[model samples]
Target chain A: MAKKSIKIRAKVKEDIVTVKALMTHPMETGARKDKSGELIPAHFIQEVVCESGGKTILTADWSGGVSKNPYLSFKFKGASKGDMVKLSWADNKGKSDSVEAKIG
Target chain B: MNLKRRIVLKGTAAASAIGVAGLLAPRAVLAAWPEAAFTAKTVPEALEALTGNSAASESGDIKIKAPDIAENGAVVPVTVTTSIEGIQSISVIAANNPVPLVASYNMGEGALGFVSTRIKMGKSGDVVAVVKAGDKLYSASKGVKVTIGGCGG
Candidate 1:
C-alpha cells in the first residue's frame, strides 16, 4: 500500500473556515540532474482543489517553482464547525492524493 | 501524379481534423490545467497566457507579505492579500526565476482574497502578486534577497 501524501486541517471561526494543507512531493523541475548526471523528469503538482459540503471553494494551479512539500493556506465562508473539507492535488505525472478533515 | 495529389489532400484533411480536436480538448476536460501558461518562460508571456491581457495596473489594494531576505531559497514563504472586491483570482510570480509565474489561485464564491504558500527562488528577485477583479487586473510586488540558490541541485 502506498503512503498518504496529503495532510489537511480546517477550523471554523466566526462563520469563516480556514484551511491549511501540506502535501509531500519531490516537485522536480526536470532541470535538476541526479548524482549520475541524468536529468530528472519534471514531477510536480499542477492542480490543487479544495471542497466543502460538496461545493468547490478554491482551485490552485502551480508550477515546478513551488517548494518541495508545498504548504497552502486559505479561507472561505458558508461552512460551520463539524463540516467536512476535502483537499486534493494532481501532479504532472498523473499521481494524486486527497484527504478530508472536519472543521474544528 | 494523380495518386500523389490524392494523398496530399488526405493528409491535409487529417491534419485539420486533429487541429480542431486540439482546440476543443481543453474545454472537454473541466478545470483542466493551463499548460501553456505554466510552461511560459517570461513573466509577460506567462501573464498573457494566464490572463487574457498582460497589462496589469499597480494598486495599493493588493498587499504582498514576504521576508526581505531569505536564508534559504528553497522555501521562501509568501502571502498575498487584497481588499479588492469581486476578486476572481490571484497569481504569484517570482520575476527572476527560470519560470516567473509560480502559482495561480481561482477563488470560488464566498472565498477570501488571500493565499499563503511557499515558493522556490533561483536567486534574489521581486515577488509579484497579481489579482484579477472583475475584468481588471491589479498587482503589487516586493523584493526578496536570497542567500542561496534553489534551482541547481
Candidate 2:
C-alpha cells in the first residue's frame, strides 16, 4: 500500500493553537477476512508523533485493531504563526512517512 | 411422604442450576464481535459502555464531514464539529462497522469542540458522532459509501 499523506491546517485564535491533520494510509492489523474466508495479513502504523519546534505534542501507538487512515486533530500551546508543525507515522514493518506544515 | 419431599427438592435444585446457566449465557454470546476492525477491539466496546443507550441523531449543531462516497474502503476521511460548549470528548462510531467505535478523543480542559480525522471503513455505513458536554450526550450521523474495495481485494 502507498504511504498515507498527513495534512495539517492550523486554526489560531488569540493565544490558542489547534492543529488538524489527516493521514492517508491503511492501518491494517493483519487480522481481517475476505469474502472467501481468507485472512488478510497484518499491516499497521504502530507509532505516530506530532511535534512543535522540537517539543513533542502527541504520540500514538496503534494496535492491529485501529481503523485504516487514522485521522487526528490535536491542540498545543506555545506555537505562533509561521512556526512549524510536523506529523509522522511509522509502521511495524519499519516504514514511516513524515510531513511538515507551516502554521497558517 | 418423605420420599416425595426428597424428589421435589432435587427438581428445585436442578431448576436453580439451569437459571444460573441462563444468566451467564449472554456474556459468551456477545464475545464474537468482529475481529479485524482494528488492532484493539476493546476500544469500541468500552466506548459503547461509557455512553449508554444514546444513539446518534442529526442536528444542526453537529456536522459530520466525510466524502458522500469513498473511493477506497481502506482509507476514509471523517470530520466532526459541534456548536455546543464545554465539550469533553468527541467519538466516532461506524454504525455498520464490525467494531463500531472507531476512535475517541478526550478533550483538553477548555478545548475547542471540533475534530477531523481519516478512518478506515471496511464497508459502506453511517459514521456516528457522539459529543459530550454539559454532562449530557449528543450525537449526529452521516452516511459514507465506499465505492471500491481496498482490503487487499
DockQ of each: 0.41, 0.14
**Ten consecutive residues with minimal summed lDDT in candidate 1 chain B?**
B12-21
Question: Which one is best on DockQ?
Answer: 1
True contacts kept of 2: 0.17
- Quote model 1's TM-score for chain B: 0.79
- Name model 1 segments beyond 4 Å from true: B1-31
Cα miss at B51, model 2 (Å)? 4.5
Top of the candidates by lDDT: 1
- Comparing to the true complex, what docking class would candidate 2 get? incorrect
The candidate that wins on TM-score is: 1
Local accuracy of candidate 1 as per-residue lDDT tens digits, A23-103 = 999997665667996656667788999998888999999988899999999999999999899998887666688988999
lDDT of 2 by residue, B8-111 (tens): 54344334323432443332322322213222234345444655434444456888888999997666777787888777767777655444556655565444
Q: What lDDT does each candidate get?
A: 0.84, 0.61
